[model samples]
Target: MEAANLCAIIAHVDRVSIGKRLAEARDAAGMTQDSVARAVGLERTAIVLLEKGDRNLKVPELVQIAQVLGRPLSYFVETPVPAAVSRRSAPSLAHASTRVLDIEIDQFALDVRALVRLGLLSGAERDARARVPRSHRAAEDAATSFRRRLGLDSQSPVLNLGRVCETAGLYTFAAALGESGPDGACIEVADDSGTVGAAVINGDAGSGRRRMTLAHELGHWLFGDAYDHGASRDSERMISSFAVHFLAPRAGVQKVWSENSNSPIRDRALAVGVEFQLSWSATVGQLMNLALISHAQHDDLKLREPRAGDYLRLGLSWVEELEAPYLSPGFMAACLTGYTEEKLTEARVLGLLRGRLDASQLPQIEARSLEDLRQAFMGHGG
Candidate 1:
């Protein structure tokens, strides 16, 4: 009787711990109790009870909740890891709509943290960062330093920005932030174990714009400007400087400009834009900043933005480079490892892939227990 009572007490303690974790994960996901309850097919009251340790959770129910929360089952069953989030969004998007994306980006970072915990991913490397550039010129210089740091040639275009970012230790992904939301948002989630850095660009934006936004967010992550929220106009300008220079270094721009000196300004802008994978505005703006074009010339060039046909005529591929259903290489690798090792379910793997793949695309494997039956089907008699 005494053992039964002790076991009951331990179970109660476990329930309380799980309840606390549920609440934390819900909060991290930016989900309301009512919303979560609806997704979990439970009453709001039930969710409240679950989060308050006033109710016991069935395994199936918990699994459903975990899926709804975009969390791994281990996240709830194991001891909770401590996490602190530092985030920044475009101040222009500091409204209700952006909050939805804020949740999305935060969830991405938390997912990366979960992968780190599982020894499948590495956390943020604070040691890799240098001091934040203090001025616009400094930011520009830092951009050059960044090129050197990444082993990128000063005159080379970054063909694969997503892969490049992963090389620099920042996980990058795309999210549907809609037309009115911020261009992108970056987050750093710190725990006792380490910090996980992630950036989510607005996939709905134009491909060039998405690439520029990603570079802007990469500036934020590299400089530890996690919580700026674009509050300061000067700070925003500095980051913009970083982004422009990072994407199209001044030396690269000059080289391209000189190479196309005989071309019309529109053609020249298009050439620079295509080569650097920059938007027309960014390309022209960089030209103006370099004093290669007068203010009047900049205005005239900006007015005549190149169309898709123009790029096609130039033999440039008009691929949507930063389109959605995009996952970072590292994140995808971790998901594959987790799934193949039977540590993650097909649903969870699909969820993490975010439409990059589907169920039919997963590896086909007969259960080990059914191997003999599989051999019989293959006509290998035992």
Candidate 2:
């Protein structure tokens, strides 16, 4: 039979037999339904229902479950096993499906895989209190706390958001297209694209725009928002605000501005760089919140066109002719490598790594590779 037909057969067999067949498959493999549920974030009861043919299943969910069971979806279709048995340690399934690239791209898929792996490995069990703040003030307050946790001084200079994301253990990528979907997205191996770590930014945009997009996506990841491949403008605004506060805390910006009232807002923008809109807006908002700037000045500034040119010029000087780190090769390499290493090892052991590596593209490495591998194995590595 053709591979596709075989896969369909497997899926059909699993469904018709009321999960008894599935339970036997699990038993033969020595895996519990609970384990599969945990891996996919489904309820244990749902697994029982699935096995018993009592619940209808979506194609995607069915595919995922079949993958976890180490058979093609068609396997379930062809031969339904009885539900009485259980299994242990079923083979790991690919995390996502494969699709033709909707857009042409550059860069290694392995690196992409690595980034997804790192993101999963570094995934935070978000605190309930980490909800998005309502007002700008609340947002700023949260930013301050977060910055403190990172041991950053409020006034410390920041440029190149990709670097910031890398530091925070996020996997990010720049894409040439600006599709109608999200500025970027996080996905597991199970998504059709089968990418592990990726955040697509508008590659056509200037460096400044790319930085903003990176920060925006990182904000979603950090804030623990459910992954939405298509985020709305309002969601972008909220995530943008979160990024602003995350990068430039209110108190520090206020203190710096207070020390130098004559410091041109233009200069502050320059000092930070082109991606400073959110930071600048947040700073001005904080001043207004503290009753420093009048309502009129705030309104005027908000209405003003952003001085992107001015900020770029000033920011360039501060960096002593070195391009922003986000634009640097080292930063990109570190981010891609760090994320890939973290994810592949973690997700593989966790049974989350899916898909096959294109061995032809795998890189030759040094003895340090072993050291790095050991570090990740111990969970002490990035």
Q: How many residue pairs clash in each candidate?
A: 0, 44
What lDDT score is found at residue 174 in candidate 2?
53
**How far out, in Å, is residue 308 in model 2?**
7.1
List the global CA lDDT of all models: 0.75, 0.47
Q: Write the per-residue lDDT of candidate 1 for residues 216-277, one digit (tens) a residue.
A: 87877787754433335466678888999999998999999999899887887888888898
Deviating ranges (above 4 Å) for candidate 2: 1-111, 114-129, 178-182, 187-197, 206-208, 227-237, 263-292, 302-382
Model 2 over residues 1-382: C-alpha lDDT tens digits?
1333444454444454637556655664558989989877799999899888887766566667766766433334432111101111113211111111111111223334433435422333334345555556666676667667667777764555555555554555454342332333433222233322334455444444455556665665555554342444355456666666665555555665665567776454334332243434554554565566688877766566455465555443222211111222333454435434432332222221122223333333334578777876789644
TM-score winner: 1
Model 1: lowest-lDDT 10 consecutive positions? 80-89
Model 2 deviation from the true structure expressed as Cα RMSD, one decimal place = 14.6
